[model samples]
Target chain A: MRRPMPVLAAGQVHEVHGEGDDRAAGLAFALGLGTANRQGAVLVVRGALRQGLGLYGEGLARLGIDPARLLLVEARDAAALLRAGLEGARCPGLALVLLESEGPLKGYDLTASRRFVLAAERTQTPLVLLRHAARPQPSAAHTRWQVASAPSLPLEAPPGAQVRPPGLPMIAVEALRWRGGPAGQTWHLQWDEQHGGFRDTTGSLGGTPNRNENARTAPSGAVLPMAALRTG
Target chain B: MAVERDAARHGLAPGMTLADARARCPDLATLPHDPAADAALLTHLAKAMHALTPSVTPDPPDGLLLDISGCAHFFGSEAKMVAKATEITGLSTIHALAGNPAAARALARHGTPAQRRAEDVAALPVSALDLGEAATTALRRAGLKRLGDLVTRPAPTLAARFGEGLVLRLRQVMGDVAAPLAPQPVQAPIRAEARFAEPIARTDDVLEVAEDLLRQVAAQMEQRRLGGRHFALTLHRSDGARRRLLVETGQPTRDPPLVVRLLRERIDSLADPIDPGFGFDAITLSVKRADPLDARQTGLDQSEETQDSLQALIDRLGVRLGQDAVLRLAPADRHMPEAAQVSLPAAELNSSVSFHLPAMPRPLLLFDPPQGIEVIAGVPDGPPLRLRWRGAVHEVIHAEGPERIAPEWWRQRGGHMGEGATRTTRDYYRIEDARGRRLWVFRRGLYDGMENAPSWYVHGLFP
Candidate 1:
């Protein structure tokens, strides 16, 4: 196991403990959140459709940052995603290219994927990849994350209403790897309904390994939270 | 005696024995009196005889007997009819008329075929009565010599005493009993023959004449409510040369337009060097086999949908591709695929059009013989796992059950094959490849049944 290093993407939520500089410092140490070491670059946010991107955007705005700094690119196919990456660097002020990887199965062979890795290296444009296959992909991706959402607590128990309830559920983002950041970390946060935003959590939800219930369900002793884990 | 000199030189004098005559003149040619040859000659001559009524009988060894009783009045009188027959034979032969066979034999043998008066017969000896030598000798000894003398006797006693031969001979010449000469049968082949007014060297000229003749046959067929399937076109040249072309329809049809089309197609290939002579003046159309056309069906509008006549297609295709190039497939008896069809050219396919055979599953792609295939399978009698067909390997994903089609056993026991040729035991299978390519293949023989080894062959591709 490695130390936890936490980073906030444009569409993510990070929690702080207590209040003032001490609380902020404790939260920063615990989450490993700090200013990025590199210049203008890509910031990949890993999760599923179950964990809404709207909630993550609210957390970044809480840090008094403008959402316009990130470029959201929904690339459906591999060719479209690859093109979008190179085009992001050409924009000069662009920092990130967000690609949604879902719908239908298509794969890039080892040779084709190596070319994408080399292209990213030559242009010095960091690349991010998301996968939705049943098994954990062993690939040339820099890091992997097991992300999912937590169950929503009740606000008002409606009468015969089947709509989505309030109090946006918490997302359990498991940092499976990190090329530049400290790895083997997990975080849980809830979207704040008062300010119509998401906020960082204050308490640790099992900081160490607990394998009996969660590990029995999680693959490789790592569980993500965005939607209920359905094993195939 | 030019007659005696010619007959003597030709070795045919009456008293000159044919053998003795052949010995005196070493080059003298003699033939056994061939009644068959004589009959064949009469048969051909009968074609020319059609100009004078259809009745003409070959008089066995020497002459022709025609029942021209009613026919004689048409040529004015007996003398003129005799003169006409003489003219037709070119006056080199003889003709006769009498009241009986005995009398006619006396007149025709002694007199020329040109002379019809009884006086020409009067000078002939009593031996010319065609009676036996004994009867003639008895008549001569009794001093009752001529037919004129026999006429004075009581007719009943003459009949009671003379044999049936003498009675029959007497009755034939007297015209008491008709000889009933066989009418020369004109075969009248299903042909359209036209002799041109001017010798036609051009193809167009022949086609024009053919069109007219076809129309005539078409009208005749319409009257009889019949349709002809086979027709021959004969072109008579002025030099007595003949060029004939035959065409047949897939279905019986008497349409002039179709006949004209077939003829035009045939005439298109006729070369110019086959020159028509000075001119032709006669044309004829004859039917070979007439099929009754149902008036009920043909009365509908002339559209392809209205009738199921194969003639319309045969005519259209036969014109472009030669008649032989178009063929109709007729099922024949045999297990071998090659023997399964009697592939007759469209023209020859018409006459023997009806065929009967039991229903069976027939292959659409029937190779003369099947091609061998290389296959790697799970086992013998098991479905193929990988088939190397047409220089490529196709992996099988799924296979259907075998549909066993047995060979027809009885039909194969003839011709050049002695015995070693074994019958095929086919087990057909439907197999699908991994890439979704479906194929129909069969195993030739069972694993241990009878063969060098079991073999697999791809027969067809299934969609």
Candidate 2:
């Protein structure tokens, strides 16, 4: 049986978590949601440290997000990040606010999360809290998602080529908690740069029987059975 | 060796030797001269004179020149303006008004009351020309002691006897030619100030005064069709201490409430809060920079309102955080990854250049200095098979071609063939690891048999 794709509602707080090496994927997913909404400008607030490198404008444009409409605020610490996030959430002109921080964000407790939710709801602006290298905790978020990188589909190569290049970016997104809807659903989505949104590729990967063995060993593929049990 | 009135009565005067002045007046008291202190006093007096007119020029040493031709009516007459200036400076001054700067300067310094009141330049002494002692003595010895004797003579004859400088000085003092005066550059009078009978220490009362002053300034700006981009509020304490608050906006604005809001944010974010020590006795608001802004209609359209709110948000963030903390990304026209884009403060960025999307895919995040990695390639010049980065080994699952990028020779010193040259060619590759983490790695230098082996670096990460 086919199931409909779940969508995050606006005017609420959502959380996205990416462990250790998968932090970039979490940031990319958050940016995808921001660009797909296409309201006003997007404000991205992050701490100074643990950002490995900085955001590249050309790379942002390649992801179909306009660099001109992006405002980057680098805070000195998590507290400053939360303050900037609260300010951004209060702005009604912003379509989305992305708050990124590493480690356990002590300042983002229940009170802070509820404050962000109240501000977002008042302005009808969506807020996405991106946590890197941190475990999920209880909060007033509308939904919580765990993201990990997935192998992209191979690009077309010449005849008898020894190796094929990676194609567009792909990621595995699993819903850990849903406030009003059924949770525990996993989706493998590939970024479509031309259309500037995600395309469901869960069925296409199943059709490639020759690559099934490799997929079974992948971390993204291992989460399917657990998700199935929770949904059932 | 200048003296006060009592010493002058004792027959002492300036330009006399100290020993001679002491001999002339046995009880004379003198202190060393400080030119710096004199200059500071002159500067202070000049600033004080700005209230009377905008064209007050300091004559240095001990004088000021005021151009009161059109500004005298503001004080009812020139005498009243001079009286007000004296009151403001609290100094007994000798002032005069004439047709030109040189005439006024000479009249204030040398002319007697009768000569000044009659406005008779020709009746004054020849010393009024200020052409040095040699010329004055020559004129005096030639029985032409007064300016009237020189005025009656022909110009060529006067120039021939007393030199061209004397003729020019004579003409300048007689108002025959205009003299140049360097007046201080004055800003527009978009200022409002208030003084309280009793000092107010409460922050609320201070803000109330600020609001009142802002309303007055806004009205002045509206009348001129101007908007301020920078506003400064200065509070004067009863004990002579001053506290100043400055607020800036992204666009020219005349809204008093918006300015007050920004000022409140600035106060809240201050590292050292305003103490209001001994309370504030006076408050003044001034616009430092203004731009031509016409009256704007509000609630025009949804897009306009959205833009307005966005600008307001940027301004607020800039005030709370530092101006540099809030930034916007602008594309730079360069091929190097580090120079491809620049982050600039949102308030200062007015870039109109369109961003050119790179033909090849770029990573989402780029390291400023690419991190080095240990790689074991399949061949000496081929793609990597496995790489060790940050103390971890990653097996390459998929590999792309080696897109070679040559160094920009024009930007390098020695044109790529000297000991001082630092840059080299790089071959970039898009490689995906076993865990599906794609990275942009480049091999620095070539594997040719000329130098040492080439090294690899991870330049960026892909999402």
Candidate 3:
């Protein structure tokens, strides 16, 4: 049995990217769920206050995650955004920090990335670098994911019209690089809006909604079923 | 070239050569004149006098003008205040009081008694007018050795002969015209001082002294129901050199320990460390800016303390790494994406200014100068079809806008007609390249000859 774990373990630097607000919201929700004790805040380094609020507030709420634990800090440039992330990591009280910056940031060189990794390790905090429109580059991050909006399974349509409100957001995520685990993994994770968490739909092309409703154990902590192992 | 009163009695006048004065009086003692050193000492003394009154201006060369209008009563009376000043200044100061600044200044230098009469100022020598040597010589050569003689002359003739300077000086000294005294930057009313019995040189000792002074200031601020937003620490060294350190907080605070820690960080990070040359004879801490500090009730969860600790961290970092080094990006009330947010010093950010995230979908990264690119478009006002940026050509697969934004006419009025001001209307577009990389592009200016031909620029990137 196998399970897809969304946990960003301590000291690991995770890189995630996608279109619009899902990247930040998905990561915050995943990281928030993994940590049993929510004593520290989840920092988001991004501008556009309303955008962050909408994504985190609505997105987290849909996943049944509390949005109050998220804190947004705006930075002037990519380098500043990285510095803010590193500073946040130095605080042992912080659970995770997400640096949402433009990809191919000019000043974020190898040395700067290494410093972030080392600082995260020292403070026992996980860091996620979310880049936009950026090409893959060598970094100290432990995992890298390329995410996109997936066509969610349509909800039961009313009679002949077949019209329905948009389904819960589903992200098609590809693991481009994984340091410790299997690389080149893919998954279509549907957000369980009412549960405030994510559900793995790797069993079938159109997995029945809430297939993992009864299996509540953390995937990394428990054994996974055979269907989830198809793509890894 | 100024001579002591005794030297003047001995016929050694100002403008007299040093050799001539020494020749006239075989036992005459002379020391080199240091104008810079004198000004510094005068400023230090004036700061010390701030303990007596807030309005103390250094009347350079060797005097301070104290405006004790309503403050004199603090020491019981004007006479007692003067007595207190003499005591504080170590009996070296000569005090005088008059109705006007010019009169008071002239009387103080001339050792004239406290009298507001115009005739009393006139009785003093013309040198008391503080006119330069050329004008003083011109007045003396005209047989007007006393201010009284100069004032008695016909006003028009005096103006014509000695120029307007002498006439103005006569009117000022006689209290006949208004003369504004530019006071030293007024010191804050809340301050604490400590004069050491023995000068201390070690860094630890200096910090201890600063901490003690901070405690006193913090207590005073507490009594007034205020917190200090800015603090200034002035250290008067044993050799008379003074060093001042200033630190500003993100929010008003009355916590002495936090204030001391911030000051220590500032001192430790100075490019040139605070050298308590020989030692520091006196140290003063002043609350340069104070704000009303209402008591905050913290919930049992201690959420407020978390905010305070975060602010304290920012303050400490700001002091150590220079205020400009630590910055926070805040929303600006401008439509231009680059101008939509501003970077402010972390220390200057207050809790009062709420930063609302802009509602519009702005790009993740904005080009600071908005780099221009060569573009091929169907129509002048349409989205870019293919653009050459940074020497590479990007084919536009899908495009989304002609979001028109006009130049602010009110800003153009009375503003320098520079490149930014002369900008015409802009049409922005959110375009996706062939590789699915999203870019925010714009066409600057219009084809209607409002500015140069419409040019293309890649303004930002969408993540």
Candidate 4:
């Protein structure tokens, strides 16, 4: 059964935590939510991390976010990241602000999160905080989500074909906390590039496991998938 | 060693050995010569001479040439202009007025002040030609000791005897031929200044004067249907120290209040606050760069207002954080992943470049140089069955093919088939592990059985 994807309200602060090596999933989820409306430019303030890679424009375009409408600010430290996030959230011209950080940020305490909430409320701008390799902490966020990568369904091929490629990018998101709604609801969603939104892909064969089921315990690892025959 | 008037009176001259000069005057004081410092001082003096004329060329070592053809009327006469130039430089100057640059340079350096007339160029010595030592000595030996003697000689004979260089120099010095003068390029001044009789020390007072000057400049820009992108406010202190404060905008703007706010932001962001050490006697505001910005009516929709607000926010943040801190992503037409996008400063992004989406799925986060990983593939050219990365092992559940991407051979150091090529072909795959963690990994080289074994690397993470 398909479940309705949780909607993140505007004019509030929301947190997304990456589980294990799923930092990219968290970032992609936040970007999907931020660029959902396609209203105005999205401001992304990123703090320094151990990883040396940066955001790629081709990937952003493929994800349905216009590269031209993306404003990026690389903060040298945590304090700068908070400052840029607060300032961006206060601006009425931006549609959304995404603050990405790694590990435990020093200055992003409850007080700083409250300031961001206030600023975002004043401007009616949605603020999405994407945290990688960080634990859940006390904050003023209206909702918090724990996100991790999920295996996608393979594309259908002819009877004689030897291989089937992966379909779309999929993720398993669990609602850790909701301000006024029921919490702890898990959903397996896949990015639909044609519609520019996430589609619920739970309970399908050869896809992700059922909701709340640890993906490591799934029984789909025994079958050996055929090698793809196409070459670039 | 250059001697002063008193030392020259005691028979000491420039270019003399220090021992000989000290023997000539035992009490003589000497200082080491610095050509770089001399050039810097000359440049400073040339900048001060801008008040006399817009066209001022610094003649190297120790000379300045000013093209005062039409600028003489600014000071009522050429003599007063020369006096003003002398006063501004605060140095002894030998000024000359002539028709051409070469004649003027020769007359100023070699001729006497009484011979400043155009016809008196002939009376100058043969050294005025400046044709180097050998040419000058040959000219003197040929009985042409003066410029008058060279001018009377036939041109063909002179060219045949002393080479074409001497004849060209003779014509240039005699003003028969014109030589192009490379003057320092100066921008048209769009500035306003206020001079106070009594120096003011208060910060508020200085800002008030600055506001007044900004208003004047804004009005001038409005008249020309233009807007300023960069503004510089210079404060001249009574003790002769000058302080400059600069502010730039993301878009052209002439609104005084907006500019004043930016100026205030610039002042506050300064590492060391502006100090009115001895008070400021004058303040000048100049528009360093101006662009044509036509007036537009506000639309009923909020789009225009939103763009204006966005620009204002960019300028504000750029002033506080730094210009480079605020950036916009622009697409680059390159095949390589890292070179596919460029981050440019927000203020300088005039046009939006759209990105063309690739046919293949690209990972959201791409490692700059793909990190190496240990892979256990089923075959040399087949997909990986298991891989270990960052001290973690993962069993591959679903794997995709080798999407081969060759290196850009045209961008190689040598020819396309060069022997010392470092970059190898890569075959990428999108793989999902047992835990459903998707990764984009690549094999470094092919298994053609002619070279070493190929290695695998994890390039990016899929969401």
Task: Please provide TM-scores, in order, for all candidate models, with all chains considered together.
Answer: 0.37, 0.73, 0.53, 0.71
lDDT for each residue of candidate 1 in B1-463, tens digit (9 for 90 to 100): 1124465455456656656776777666555666677677666665566667666666656577666657877889988887777777653666667654445655777554444564444445556657878987877887876655665677787777665666566555555666555555654445555655456666676667777888888777777778887787766666677766667666677777767776665565445544556644454556666888855554454343312333443454454445553444455655543454455565454443333322322222233345567888776776677888758787765565466655554544653242423336678765655443445578876676555777888764321
lDDT of 4 by residue, A127-217 (tens): 9999988989999999999888877776774354345566688888888899877577666677876677676554444544543465223
Candidate 3 TM-score to native: 0.53
In Å, residue A15's CA in model 4 sits off its true spot by: 1.2
What's model 1's lDDT at B225? 79
Clashes of 3: 7
lDDT per residue (tens digit) for residues B187-273 in model 2: 567899999999999888888888899999999999989999999999999999999999999989998888988898889889899
In model 1, which runs have C-alpha deviations exceeding 4 angstroms?
A1-232, B1-176, B182-255, B267-298, B301-305, B308-310, B327-364, B405-423, B449-451
lDDT scores for all predictions? 0.50, 0.81, 0.67, 0.81
lDDT of candidate 4 at residue A74, scale 0 to 100: 77
Listed for every candidate in order, the interface RMSD values in angstroms are: 34.1, 2.0, 8.5, 1.8
> Which should have the higher DockQ, number 3 or number 4?
4
In angstroms, give how far residue B347 of model 2 lies from its true place: 0.8
Candidate 3 TM-score restricted to chain A = 0.76
RMSD of each: 31.7, 12.3, 16.2, 11.3
